[model samples]
Target: MKVLHVITGLGIGGAEQQLRLLLRHLPVRSSVVTLTNPGAVAAGIEADGTPVTHLGMTGNRDLGALPRLARFVRQGRYDLVHTHLYRACVYGRTAARLAGVRRVIATEHSLGETQIEGRPLSAGTRALYLASERLGTSTVAVSPSVARRLAEWGVPPERIRIVPNGIETDRFAFDAGARRRTRQALGLPEDAHVVGGVGRLTPGKRFDRLVRAVASIPDARLLLVGEGEHRAELLRVAGECGAADRVLLAGACEDPPAAASAGPALPELLAAMDVFVSTSPDETFGLAVVEALAAGLPVLYVACPAVDDLAPEAAPGARRIGESVPELISALRGIRDARLARLPLPAAARRYDIARSAEQLMTLYDQAVHGTPLPAK
Candidate 1:
């Protein structure tokens, strides 16, 4: 089937990279449209042979974007329209309907309890979201927690489908050669205990707490991947905690399958780490924790619906810790003292495989187009 994906931006975020990965595996003709910045992920998608169009949407209030997007949808004559992220869902749904496309699917990638995509969820936001949601055929939640959240927000339970975000599991498999090279490239001591976290460097992620926790451990070093507004604040927090030198902000790294970029790829960085931690108390899906588990690293997370919702045995290497610096310190100490070796890849990793997710999504797409009944959760 011919599918067109609309998204807010093609940046180096989970949803964007997930789209790129999905495009590679999905057995359908697909194209992409970004409502704003077409960044690194856009390049990667194009490199993978998918056409990408930037809508040049100036801001949330850009009414002109509606007609422009609608025109593109009409011209493409897409069999289905799949939207990702908030702005794209709203505009893409409207545009698809305007273009006479009835089967529109929206995947809510970053909706949290109090926020949607790291921004506070005001009444206006919810109103717009619910209103636009009515235009779509189905809304795919990245996790069960997200499905529940959508229901609480008044979305019809029948319209929500749980298609967990997936990863190319083997790409993240731990490599001993990569570990040595990455550590040496980053100037990390071979014996140093590296504690890593990957996500947007936002306050909600509580990366400051991670910096402080690593600072308390004399021999532990913190490696933060991904970039955001909180970089300066995190550095300041590191200085205050006397761990300024120990904290290394590795900026953003693209997915491993993407074309080689300047920085170290995610799997390489994962190889360099001893353990992984996710301090965010609010997470729709803890993708980084899953990636760490795929790398066979023991994971310490304050909240991860992806792991918590699954059977414990699914992620044997992941441990849910408390949401405080002291608790983080204790967990890190426990890991250090135990001298835990790299873990075996977890069942959870295989469960969320990109190939599996693509197949699930393709089924949804087929059902949506053929007016077939959706399978029960």
Candidate 2:
């Protein structure tokens, strides 16, 4: 089937990386369309042999862009149009319907409560979101928590499907050689007690909390990875926490796989770390946490709906915390080597393999194609 994926812009985030893997591995004719000019994400998609489009949009609500997209979808006669993020879902679904495409699917990757990055929306933007939900046939939530949030936003529960983002667990499996090679390449001390985190420098990520927590741990160094607008602020926070020298800001690495841009690769980085730390307030699904488990690295996560649900049986290395700074400092100090080593990360990660997640998505896509009802949210 000729399938089209519409993403706002394939920035190196968890949802974008998951889509990258799915498009590369799925045995289907797929192309990716980006609303804005493509960057590293597009380059990675191109490397995988999937076609990429930069719709040349200057802003979110480009008027002419809509007809242009509608015409393209009409001409391609696409079997399915699946979208990621808010902008693409809004405009992509609207255009797909205007083009008379049979199916349009949208996946909610981030909880809307925290997804807003800039100015609060004006009235028109809110109206557009409401309209987009009506046009899309099926809505997929990255986690059950997201599904619950989507329902609160007026999406009928029956129209939503829960398909937690999948990871290629094999990519995360413990590799002692990789640990040695990566550390050697980066010039880290052989005995460094590494603490690592992966995410854009965003307020919701609570990276500042991590910096504070790191200050409470002895002989610990931190690796903060990924690129975003908040990089400067994060650096400032590190200084505020007196952790400047103890932190290594990789900015962002230009890894060809681009998988290194997020998710399992971050866990691979965790393989070299003694502990993994995430301070994100309310994660839909702790993809990086699972990746850490897969790499046999213990983690300390701020309690949220998704983190609370991550079965300890799967992540024996995971510890949940309420919103307390003292609690975080204590958690960091309490991570003993034996306890961290006991977490069955590989076994835990095996259950979240992308192959299984893809099959479930494919089933949902098949049903969407025939205008069939989605599972109850």
Judged by whole-model lDDT over C-alpha atoms, candidate 1 comes out at 0.93
* Candidate 1 C-alpha lDDT tens digits along 256-360: 546656667899999999999999988889899999999999999998999999999999899999999999999999999999999998999999999999999
- Candidate that scores best on TM-score: 1
What TM-score do all the candidates reach, one by one?
Answer: 0.98, 0.90
lDDT per residue for candidate 2 within 142-249, as digits (tens), equals 777878777877788878888777777766667777787667766668678888887777776787778777866766788877777878887787788777788776
Q: Evaluate model 2: give its TM-score.
A: 0.90
Pairs clashing in candidate 1?
none
Residue 205's lDDT within candidate 2 is 79
Alpha carbon lDDT at 24, candidate 2: 66
Model 2: CA > 4 A from native: 112-126, 253-268, 303-306, 336-339, 346-348, 370-377
Least accurate 10 contiguous residues by lDDT in model 2: 255-264
User: How good is model 1 by TM-score?
Assistant: 0.98
